[model samples]
Target: MNVSLQIRDVPGEVRDAIAALAAANGQSMQGYLLELVRREARVARNRTLFDRLAGKRVRGLVVDDIVTTIRRGRDDPDRADPDVA
Candidate 1:
């Protein structure tokens, strides 16, 4: 389903800035706004997924532990394979 959205009583400067951004990106104002809304929706969906996983255990693994292990591996210079280059 598609619906039209209207912004009432917008300040001239803000509206102009949005128009300039849309033009610079080679999109019409409507297209630019639609993209922005779609991106925000994806962010919201990801946040909801994270919230749902906040307290549950997945195979007895802690999220923080997983993150720390990944970071440690990333930060170790010796982990890089020079021969690959």
Candidate 2:
């Protein structure tokens, strides 16, 4: 499948640089952009790195939670085990 995009107001110098970089990477400008899109899509689907943060609330953390988790990890050796209760 092929998609067409229209990019406007691109400075000539920047466009030349992008074209040179893409050529160095063995891709046309369009191919480079498409590859970048595909990579980002795959990474998003993997949901391992930064994708786990989607639609989550994290503004309510206090100092107690931090200290508690640290203490628990240090105090309990078996807490991280899944097969043992």
Candidate 3:
């Protein structure tokens, strides 16, 4: 199911700007606004999700610093085992 929104009393300049942008992108004004809205929503969802995953013991990263620090009981090559035990 889909519904439409009505934004009233918008300034002429704002409407014109939206029209121009939509034209530049070869989309209708509705498509332009929907795309912008969808993009923002995706970012919001990612932030909320990653925030929830934020703190448990994690592995230290290499390369461009992506992975978090290593949790205990994980054998990393950098840490040598004692007596090969």
TM-score leader: 1
The candidate that achieves the highest lDDT relative to the unseen native structure:
1
- Candidate 3: C-alpha RMSD to true structure equals 7.9
User: How well is each residue in 1-85 modelled by candidate 3, as lDDT tens digits?
Assistant: 7778789999999999999999999999999999998899899999998888886547674744443344433556677778797
Q: Write the per-residue lDDT of candidate 2 for residues 1-85, one digit (tens) a residue.
A: 7667788999999999999989999999988988888999898778765556655758878999999988988789666667667
Error of 2 at 64 (Å): 24
Ranking by TM-score: 1, 3, 2
After superposition, the stretches of candidate 1 with alpha carbons farther than 4 Å from their true spots are 58-85
Q: What is the lDDT of residue 57 in candidate 2?
A: 55
TM-score, per-candidate, Cα-based: 0.65, 0.45, 0.61
- Worst lDDT run of 10 residues, candidate 2, spans 48-57
State which candidate, 1 or 3, has the greater lDDT. Answer: 1
What is the per-residue lDDT of model 1 for residues 8-85, given as tens digits with 9 covering 90 to 100?
999999989999999999999999999999999999999999998976746878889999999999889889766697
Count clashing pairs, candidate 1.
Answer: 0
Q: What Cα-based lDDT does every candidate model obtain? A: 0.92, 0.84, 0.83
